[model samples]
Target: MTDKAQKPSTRLIAVTLDEASIGHSTPDIEHERATAIWDLVEDNAFFPCGDPGTGPYALHISLMDNRLVFDIKREAGEQVVQHHLSLTPFRKVVKDYFLVCESYYAAIRTASPSQIEAIDMGRRGLHNEGSELLRERLKDKVEVDFDTARRLFTLVCALHWKG
Candidate 1:
């Protein structure tokens, strides 16, 4: 991990999801969203390409016209850059993540410990896959470390929640 203190300006300070774009979410989805945001703000590396404003950034995420949007700004609310990533590349992995998540959640309450662990492993794998894809997709626009990408992937999956 990069020394967060040394590169403090490259970190994210806040994250907000567009409520209107969120539609209606189940309690589980809401919990997932909250957890992802809390984890993200606690630790993340976000540096917009070609912008050297020395900014601890804030990110506003939303989905508009079937595109995933990343609205980055300085911690003090000055615009930095905005990126719209195509959702096509994410569709399959996101779908698989959701399926594994559903099974994991269900297994947690009813299955044996070993069974839950198995499902959890699959869930984590899918999460990692999605995170890697996100990191690749954002490579040209914004640079993010693996953990940050994982948390961001969780938020992305939260946005895709249709319940």
Candidate 2:
């Protein structure tokens, strides 16, 4: 075995949250969703950023600009927050987004290197489909107030990348 010390992996994006993503004021709601979502995530291997977690601890849920933010980090990224969600039925919102991220990563991980390479050449390539899926997970008319959705997009894209 090589004797060199393994380098500590670094994420370029980091997610940060204030007290608003779920709004502590709505503790009843926050607690319920946080608990459920947290549990659901814990069982899964990858996080929004495609990095596996001890659970869902890295997803920073907070309220920002009157919307809930599910901040996430993946693939050498830092502080990449989810698009602010301001629609009702928060449970459904969370559920869809989580599923989309989870499914994408699963596909990316299992695909052979040759297949992954083919992803770039397909008509509906991996990148395009992934972006569409992410976009679909977001509800219409919801407030996704990020200067550039790419911050969150980066997180989604990061999922499936092997460190």
Candidate 3:
């Protein structure tokens, strides 16, 4: 076998949020959505088990029937894998994340610098927690770096957001 085939390098070339299905989002949430997709496409590692080809993949994220769906495809649009992860595990984290983000935004506008920094720290902690959870949930299906999981978690939260 060729060296390249033996050691595959994986990445995401594109990411799409199924906004129509998830309903509308606030401008803040929309901004987060755009940022996550941009960061993820710019750099990430995603290796779906059993795929022979190396990839710069395309990912479509959506929420359906309360489950988060990861629709992965090759760069040329060939199907790779569709992973459906239950939202139950993420319910508390997502809710907490939203609350923290709201506080952070408000703090930025009215609170002292120290207070804002504290809230921002909490927000980052919750974000890390959510990302770690995602990594665990996808462990069996795909291998992704913490940074990739972090960005994916942001998109997942965007999918879960109702407002």
- Give the alpha-carbon lDDT of every model: 0.89, 0.39, 0.84
Q: Candidate 1 — number of clashing residue pairs?
A: 0
Single out the weakest 10-residue window by summed lDDT for candidate 2: 1-10
Model 1 RMSD vs true structure:
1.7
- Candidate 2 Cα outliers beyond 4 Å, as residue runs: 1-34, 45-57, 74-77, 86-135, 139-163
Better of 1 and 3 by TM-score: 1
lDDT of 2 by residue, 54-151 (tens): 22234554555555456654444455446565534343434454455455556588977776555435422433444444444453412222211323
Worst 10 residues of 3 by lDDT: 1-10
lDDT per residue (tens digit) for residues 67-124 in model 3: 8889989888989999999989999998999999889988888999999999999999
Best candidate, lDDT-wise? Answer: 1
In every candidate, how many clashes are there? 0, 15, 0
Q: Quick one: best TM-score, which candidate? A: 1
Off-target runs (Cα >4 Å) in candidate 3 are: 1-9
Model 1 reaches what TM-score against the true structure?
0.93
Model 3 — TM-score against the truth?
Answer: 0.89
What candidate 1 gets wrong by more than 4 Å, as runs, is 1-6
Check candidate 3 and list the clashing pairs.
none
lDDT of 3 at 106: 87
